[model samples]
Target: MQESWRDEVSLLPEELKEILDITAKHNRWRKYETINLIASENTMSPLATSAYMSDMMHRYAEGKPFKRYYQGTRYVDEIEVRVMKLMGELLRADYVDPRPISGTTANASVFRVLGKCGSKAVIAPVQAGAHVSHTKFGTLGALCIEHIEMPYDPDQMNIDVDHAVKLIEEVKPSFVVLGASVYLFPHPVREIADAAHSVNAKLVYDAAHVLGLITGKRWRNPLDHGADLLTASTHKTFPGPQGGIIATRDGQLYKPISRAVFPYFVSNHHLHRLPALAVTAVEMKHFGEAYADQIVRNARALAEALAAEGFKVLGEHLGYTRSHQVVLDVRKQGGGAKAAQLLEEANIIVNKNLLPYDPPDAIKDPSGLRLGVQEMTRYGMKEDNMKDIARFMRRVLIDGEDPRKIAEEVKAYRREYTKVHYCFDVNTLEDGKLYLLY
Candidate 1:
């Protein structure tokens, strides 16, 4: 009987149908039910989402905006120009390239532009929160560059500024990267920039995790602090589509990075994301300060709550975190991998991470869990919500409550905060809403 129904639908591939079904289920579960805390992920606004689905998705306009190899992309050209301009204004930089397909691609372009084959670079050690793309096993290795690890301060949970300065002066790297995937606090950009410049080294800040915070004016701007270039993913804390941007205040470095993005790194560059990115840029320009401030507040609040619940939250001496992320040492409760899985069973999504003390091999089963509050804050969650989240986590990891039961409660709790905030309310447009212009 089931075979007969399947035969009737033979025009569509069964595998494709199953794939769509799983995707739909995942969408519902992730968007509606789970308490997602993955530091590197976020959901775009409804307006942004609408703009992401467009005719541009099917087309390719290779090369720079007006210098495309393909034809019939005049509108696409205009959008590209506008997006680049918007990004430059948002990040307060002289140049912006919205061409890299991802943050890693942006890093790759930088590695290519700044470093040739067999060049040398300095990066934060993996245990100190370096993203994989910055390491020897990633983009740097692929580009044939020798990567030297900067010294890290376990007490501060960041790069040791004094030791790093000394290392940079000694090794004299081609470039020094100053950002992280599991970032908790602000990097010593200004200090490191000074040291790198003293050695004739270019400073590239991978602001992938804290770009939104910087744009929102809650964190320091690397460009202002002497960074030569900044690479970031638009989707993380920036609240845009999944794309990468390369920005710089140094006009001389712009063209080289631009060339690297085109013939070397990306071709089409995913034109569909341009309009969505523009919308997010406009949103950040207007509401970013408030949103960024709240994200940090929520993060610190979450860290404090988790610490009170007996979780060995990191960076206590540094006031927990200044960004949207909170890191917890989950080793006592059966390590990061087990704790992450246990929390996931309760719909509390998080990622296992390596702490400063973890061995290199601990990457597969690290001793830390990274939690982010930016997405939750966007969904109207506040400091109080952070407290509730910590309680849910305690139930799973500390109290050892039944995960399925806690998951039901989490779903119910999540129902109250479905609407997105800190953006223009399209719903209000229906009623012809207006406000006084101060």
Candidate 2:
């Protein structure tokens, strides 16, 4: 396997080469099947990938295109502006910064802009639906990322913004982060923004997981509801590139935010990737809302289907899920890691995750597994498909417990549904992993 990679590329920066070789081998050569259910993961458009693999990889445009510290940015500037234009239109954002390389970078930029040495940034802890990037581990370098947790309503398993707002007022934080990595329901952005306003703290909507839905209008628009800033990865439910996007709804916040994105924060932004961003934005303008709407449909369907199979699915009373992802507390289904492992053997792909307030041992091998209908849902897999998937899970984790047979059934169903006429050239791949237009 190493030999294959070595043969594929001559430039081997030893350490990176080793990791790349291993990743490729695990993904391509290993006999293990992948039914990746991690909502953060999605299939990129072929054009998006092509844009990433384009000539933009060779340039060193160190500044914003035309204003670069170095020369030869004529085309680079055009591409960057193109990305920015489409991004603003797609997000309905007042100001757009097409710089940050990942969602974490976008959040970091927001933090860096508002957070000083002793500054405070409120966050929902990971157990309470925040991403690791919101934790001490995620904010280690920044020192003094004070925690102002969003209170949860046990009845609904969502943030209690009134209480959270009270905490923000008392703390007088520098920034209030609304949104979560594992949130199973709608976020109270307006209330959160109102709370942050009470304390004069900036409100940042970390829409990393739901950008697709938000853009599609399946979910709330935090900026419209009072959020000052928005942060997200262009991927996830959006089917774009793997990069961060920042948008400010107020003109007053644009310059500082853009400066924060430039010299002070990320310099040498990937110019080549800008075109991919443009392509993604173009795709968004055309199909984003539809893609996002269907993603929610898939989530609700998946949730109901999983519930029917007896797993303790979260967020049913408040009208199930409004996004592409669903959370199932599978501890009753025999533990997340255990179920995920067995499912892998059966050719299904899903990941183990810590449920809200999950125990330490559960974090290690979590009690919950987050599933997404993003890629599969985009393939037009609906409520019925979700049920079939639940049955497969039952067979592997609850009943038959024989993966070979399970894999056979999965393969058959996959062959039938893989032809979901969702995107352009939908069923064009021989390996069955292909699911996008470009």
Candidate models: Cα lDDT each:
0.91, 0.76
Clashes of each: 0, 2
lDDT of 2 by residue, 1-438 (tens): 998886877776789879988998785522223455778877666556666776767777766657788877788888888888888887788688878888988877778777776677778767767887776667524555665566777677778767887888888988888788886777888888888898888898889988888877788878889999999997788777788989987888777777777776577776666877787777767777777777777778778877787778877787667777788777766788887888888888888888776854557788888887787775667767788888887778767568978887776667654432234452454764533323
What lDDT tens digits, residue by residue, belong to model 1 across residues 169-258? 999999999999888888999999999999999999999999999999999998999999999999988999999999998788898888
Model 2 alpha-carbon drift over 4 Å, by segment: 1-33, 417-438
What TM-score against the true fold does each predicted structure earn? Answer: 0.95, 0.87
Q: Give the lowest summed-lDDT range of ten residues in model 2.
A: 27-36
**Cand. 2 TM to true fold:** 0.87
Error of 2 at 271 (Å): 3.0
